[model samples]
Target: MRYCSIPCRVVGALLFGSVAANAFAQVGQQSVPLSADDNAEVEHVWRFAQETESRSSLPRAVDANWIENARLGTLKLSGCAAALVSADGLAVTSATCLRSLENWIRPDDSVFVAGTLLEERKLPGLTARQLVEIREFARIEEASEDLETGFEAELIAADDSSTFWEYVWRTYGDVRLVVIPPADVTDFGNEEGVYPRYAIDFALFRVYDGQALPLETESYFAWNDRSPYVRERLFATAFDANTPFTVITLSDTFSYNGTISPPHTTLYGMLDQYYSHGATGAWELTEDWLSGIKENDLATALNFSVVGECAQTGAGLINVDMEILGIAFDNANTEEGTRCVVMSTSGILALLRTVLKAQGVADELAEQALP
Candidate 1:
């Protein structure tokens, strides 16, 4: 019901399409009363997947691919999520991760993202920087034979379609990560039934070697060339709100094409994992531009889809199958279960390839065997 063992710091959402339109909206403008947990005092904060006091006990806890995925690395945005896409240091994530003008108010706003948006979000002098730095994609042992070369990445381009964005890591990195969420956070909204898979929340990056060259490692996620079918199992991973690594799964084949009521709403997808939080939206859209209140911002992200159409865009996406995170396999069907929704892999890949083409590196994509 709540989004965390940790507290929720949901903020007001500002939704605008064309800068000329200047369409503004707010989420739950009515002040939500903060519970003791919501308003808890200062304490330590370690991001997801980063070292933590409790990490030592979980040794052999995650797969080596996870480390590779980690090695592929991640980009730190004030309020967004991202991951390494290639060994040469390409990365991918939702194009709208940082689309929120509200997030650019910080002093470091000039750090690089979108240039034009910066000007729009701020004063005349503000220019956006697309490139950002990525730290370790994975951890190498102090004594490991492979040396670690810390590198910085550059943001080359983002597709105009907004379905996916692309960046290149100085070097490349990639690894298939099998995730097991255990007790975690899914934020797919409490007791809500609609699935939000409209953001087209995906991106691509090229990871280079430490020397800032093309990556040649065997550790990349193959393009999964084959189209996804209903009722198939897909493993998906997402970096946590902070240092945690999260993987969620779809228990069975779910659909929305013409099945659920309201024809356009009611997507059938659920996280086969456990999460403490409910969903958050990039923009809450509906038949009317205002019905969506914090759902994923497909309107802004893709510049398509009517506002409020993807009204439950918690963390910008909900998709695909198999519950892998935790050792706690009770399957109680308790409310604690993660209720999520995701777009079909076929669809995700189609959008991704478009970004790849724009980046001129479609060949860099791994070869997927037809299923």
Candidate 2:
């Protein structure tokens, strides 16, 4: 049940929020508009959608409307990004991203598993922000808008210049913890820099409105129970952890390698070297074709690529149609670069169904049409 292919590096939990982008931006230069060839590396969701719309006919790829929907469903957490999976405000994220919840649990209880809505615990001061609007301007002064009720503005400069982006976010502070597996299950092996992992590595929470009821959300990513095939086209939408502002969702495309069965259905892919050094982050999109996947059905080999190492926990792996394939929870070091290990949605749905059924709420989760 061990990963035959060993990882050189393993990423720890990363949190990104509220930091000003001025430190990461070019303080004295006018930011330039995204060029036509800006598709390779990470690009802002708005700019990426603009490019997608301009394409005459790109089959099986996301369009501007798809990007808008994804932006609305994504929530920026203090530790990582989470996707709204159900219309009733249920969100799925990496268990590692929620280690802070352990502090709230009783000291004697090793893990916190809320069996029902009544068992869910409120996390004080924890908030999740959803992007409501994105506005771009060449200069900061050109950006002026009266924020709607319950919305807040976050001004951020582009990568290297004064060009400012005003990101309006709707903050939801009444987030309640729903479920989290034990640490041993979420982080199997306890082996750093190892892969072909069998870890389920996930947690769930529900966002509540001021009335303390589940927030009704029109925008969300439906669960895709099928596992992704190798060479399948996929993309990720998440905020860059190194950036000062966490509201801007960056989009990047990559292909998935076949799953390694036996120990677990682990999805791996070839990701470029995207690592952050302290406060600065690297965004270059370069793939190493030389890195090949090692297959083993009896055991398993775990090695995959993801958008970014830090602050990417809980980011969703989406297809062109905007369906959720899996979630990025852990990263690994390979000869190629820093790659990620993704827990397939099929497996996640199975685990969640088991938990909900035990809690006598399987029917509630099944209503979402998740298999």
In order, how many clashes per candidate?
A: 85, 4
Q: Model 2, 1-371: lDDT tens per residue?
A: 11111111221211111111111111232222323233332234344466644342332223456557777777888768888877788887877777754366554653565777788888787788888787878887877667666679877675554466677889898998887765645654453543445565777789998889998987777666665644344455566444211111111323224433232344232121122212122222212211211121212222233434434778776654456667778776544345566666665555545432323333444455432
Best by TM-score: 2
> Candidate 1 lDDT (Cα, whole model)?
0.26
lDDT of 1 by residue, 1-371 (tens): 22232233322111111111000111112222222122111111122235444232222222222333332333443344443333443344432332332233344331222212112122222111222222222222311243335433322211232221122233223211111111111122322234333333343333333343444543333333232222222223332342223322223223334543111122122211111212324222222212221232222212111111121221222111111111110111222333344333233333233321221333333432111
The TM-score obtained by model 1 is 0.36
Task: Give candidates' CA RMSD values in order.
Answer: 18.8, 14.4
| lDDT, residue 339, model 2 | 54
**What local distance difference test score does each model get?**
0.26, 0.54
lDDT of 2 at 347: 58
